[model samples]
Target: MLAEAAKSQFSRDHSDHLALVRAYEGWKKAEEESAVYDYCWKNFLSIQSLRAIDSLRKEFFSLLKDTGLIDGNPSICNSEGNDANLTRAVICYGMYPGICSVVHNERSFSLKTMEDGQVLLYSNSENARETKIPYPWLVFNEKIKVNSVFLRDSTACSDSTLILFGGSISKGDTDGHLKMLGGYLEFFMKPDVAEIYQTLKKELDELIQNKLLNPKVDMQAHRELLSAIRLLVSEDGCDGRFVFGHQILRPLEISALSTKPSLFSRTESGPGGDNSKSQLQTILTRAGYTVPMYKTKQLKNNKFQTTVEFNETQIMGQPCSNKKSAEKDAAAEAIQWLKGGAKESHEQVNHMSKLLKKSKKDHL
Candidate 1:
């Protein structure tokens, strides 16, 4: 009804109507006095539309609190006092798994979802088409697929928001390395930072679970946890890399092996040194193994098994219910085989050498 009223009022004037709609829909200025709002107030056919918006905002807040979606009042101001980081953290809490990060390059700005593929930012977004984005991460409400995927009602966010409100946190392949969203994103940080992130994640999970079991839980405790989370996420001067899953899997150039021999060369220490995804890739490449490709086979129980193949030979097969887990299993098996092969060959060569030496002595 409000939309129809605004449309009818501005039907005759296209430019004013667009400006008014955008301002009304998008984030408003922090102050009570806004030139755009004033202009709309004077030109608008009725004051009821403005009143309706205010009422709607209040109702929305009420609903959020009642349903335990939020712990406290949300900041309306976009200024420094508004705590943008806190707002982002709260958004992450509610949005949880439906988050994305902005990827800006010379060519374009795209949003990469955790599990799903990349998506283009909605043209209506404030960050869209900007030469540079203010923040590296973004949390989106949802995605819609037309000709291509696009994020709707997206907001700029920071790494801290993800650490606090993102999905399951797991230890990465190496120390001081952590992965989120089932290895879709990787973070390299100090041991302390990793510990803090894990601790906060646990607290947030428990809080959310408790709230679900009983919405009438103490508001004081709820607010305190949110406060701690906000503080943790707001910390600065931390060093880490926010890497997309695809970027991690991107193959290294063949020429890079010569320049970075230490990274790609087979280790004398043994296979268990580092069987990480990248290391596995290096070992495979060195052994003349082609880039591993996967084929999915559906089973009778509606489950899937992923098979990793190299040069038409099946290196490993993984049976799991989900595609992601199955793929991980297959890759792990391939790495194990590559690592074990080296050890077996070393033993075989040593045994052959001993036999050759003994036979030479007998002949002499």
Candidate 2:
């Protein structure tokens, strides 16, 4: 499917929706329809699915024409359709709130959605075969659960695309911060940068609305805004990553924590007293990774089970009667592995502690 979508002999690094467009267009433009079966057989693609897609596409075009969304000449609508960055931005625009953070590692990467937490892409994806994607987020089509939850076809996207092309944005909990999806996704940038993105996004939305209303309207009038958008997405320095398990500490919350010295101490907190969850997150965070994620599921026996995940390690504790205790037990189980009960988690946290103490003494 990837090779077919890419239209390339060699495997490529692309997870964009336009690739799908280009592939389907290529199929339609093929001179010899006889080789269709051969192509499908060689590439492990299903001819039945392809035929359905072909039929659906024509119906879509007819519906659009009937609805006055487009005229017979698609040329006007496709003026910037080949612009890969803009196409991805458009996909993100239409697919708002379906975005997930892309955290790359040396050999592989992981995905985390706002609601689902840790996820994986199917092995067949071109993006899945690659160790890194040079973008901050992926606007996915959908997700499924087999052995584990997996994200289906997705497009790698930059921060600028999301910020300038996604849903309505709002101010965040702190200065120089912006948020979306009811504050599940947060962005921090210079205040001016935020303003620029918002300004450009507003103009972009208006231009689109105008074009939809008047298909033949001259879009060249907004060429400046178009140029700015093109420039931004192309040169985007993706200075962001997946911080999956982060939680903000409010002022009152901070004050309460400060009053309790042992709260930060593992020896004191130690997997009990609802502090296991906090301790698990703090240790992982101090180790320079995102906070650990906790997933809770209701069992058939009227019990709840929780799994705590971090650093690609997923540990599920014994089930409990309620969600809170299940999460706490899972966190405690993870803490056991992190804090030298098994290894790395505790050593790293202890290492961070030493660094903190050294810095404090040096200041004194």
Candidate 3:
């Protein structure tokens, strides 16, 4: 359908083609996932309609050349695709009553109107705050880097982002375990969480370079950064799909920076409490990733209690208020609990205790 649209060259009787072009124009505006593919598609489809108009312009130019159509001495060089000149000619005719008015007034052409009526920038008040200078990241500005990770399966392939990292590279036994977890948690967690982290790192670099302190930047970079960060914190099905058998929500001890010390530790608050699973879920969601809660455990008295059940397991927690504090906790606990399990969780608990002690000593 796209190819056919791009090549057609006819001046008249293209009502059907025009209608399709218009329909696609409408579709382009309605869809949210309309990224590069959508833009390319709409352009390809619209090109066909332009070809039809180009055909008619050729005929019109032919009449003007060669001493003119009526008084055929020498027909003008009938040019096609001369939009600017053609538009000017048409407008000139309308302005001044002359013999050319007949040609310009013809129904075959109407200034090759744009598919979109008028370009609108920042239509709403909020949009004005959100809009940024239109510096598109074109191919000229883009640089691609190939990164890879060797999976324990002994099969090496090109992977843009590495999944397993740090000293605990996936060993044969761990790889098998992770594979099982992958199968179970594919829907609930993001399988490519490490990749997501790498992406977030890159996005953060970009944000640092172009976003953070730029006063002119109203909100575009903030939105993009928010999305990138969301993806960074989102649970990559590694745990949610019951991956690894009832994954741990918080990696044991959250960081010392936790303002309330209850963000993830307050089990009494319930899954939707101020420091509950819902709060953590919100932080991840805002950052750009979707996390579905499969289960919940109350954290009263700083200990997980009970086997909480839900009618549906797919619940998303609300955003947390103390993200920076949570971030500190996440970083501190990453190595402590992520690799090990109940033991590792306990180690993280101990580690936090030491961290507090060290801080107290520094103060003293």
Candidate 4:
């Protein structure tokens, strides 16, 4: 929302959140009793909007004063939140689980979420058109699905921001391994490194809880803890990435599945051969889904098995003698499953089928 409001004042050179802070500071610096109109006009900002924001800011300060959360002066509170990195961390903290992973490849980058595997940011986001985002994560305020899933009002999040404030961190099975969002976000460190983070997090959590309980408590009293937290948040940089969902078949499992030759055919060539894969891809693409991807792996018996993935669905094919046959078999199975086979209901496909049928009938 503040994107356009801040752009003229702060230029699109920093994270979206920092732009707002810069714009507000610049506006305040330029504002005087009689010069507010000229300043807003010159910067292309709305004068009424600035007035409303000032009104709301004063109201919050008054409310905080009444609750004993702040003294008469507001500058003291500024000592903590005024730092840009801390401000970003606080935003990430409030927007926990509302995060996306930034994946960059040769040509472009994409965003992914836990629920919907692949997503995109709305065009308004500063990061939407970026080909390479330095950070591994983005904290977003909202998401909606129209033509496709879109994240809105997102700010790039550093490894430190998400690790320190994003979600509950859990100890993994191995030492120095940490997991967040039920293992979706993984943090790897030396054994001693994990201990340090856990300790700092505990102290920070305690300090926040104490401040919540005792409004009169001075947060500055824990200067050492805050300093350490700030140092980590700044210096650690974005050294990690969120875990994206994909599966590698275990060797033993693949061996067991490969042994069942009696129940399966060696290839999908009898009726559905090479053309099946293309047919499946066409159908899915026309239905507004990604073209299916085939993952082929060689087995111990020198045979290949393939898994075709699309729309977050995965279907494994019978083991075949070659990569080509394995992929064909995989696509055949996916096609059969989508046409309403034993794998269960294909609600999305079925819904699209009905719409297509209706359109044909109307034309007739």
By TM-score, who's the top model here? 4
Tens digits of per-residue lDDT for model 2, 1-364: 5655534542343664665665555555541666776666655556777788889978998898887777778788577776777777778877777888775543466777876777888776667766767666888888888878888778888778888888888876544567788766666566787788778888888888888888776777888998999899878765452122222111223233223222123333332233778767655543335667789899999999887766666677667899998887777666554433533545545533432232211110
List lDDT for all candidates, in order.
0.54, 0.65, 0.28, 0.66
Show where candidate 1 strays beyond 4 Å: 1-37, 41-53, 61-81, 106-108, 114-116, 211-227, 237-364
Those runs of model 2 whose alpha carbons end farther than 4 Å from true positions after fitting are 1-11, 32-34, 213-217, 239-364
Cα lDDT for residue 69, model 1? 57
Residue-wise lDDT of candidate 4 within 16-72, one digit each (tens)? 666656656666777845676766766677767776877888898889888888788
Top lDDT model: 4
- Give the Å shift of residue 44 in candidate 3: 11
lDDT of 3 at 102: 6
Error of 3 at 69 (Å): 47
Evaluated against the true structure, the overall lDDT of model 3 is: 0.28
lDDT of 4: 0.66
RMSD of each: 17.5, 14.3, 24.6, 12.5
Question: After superposing candidate 4, which stretches have Cα over 4 Å from the reference?
Answer: 1-14, 239-364
Give the backbone clash total of model 4.
0
The stretch of ten residues in a row with the least summed lDDT in candidate 2 is 355-364
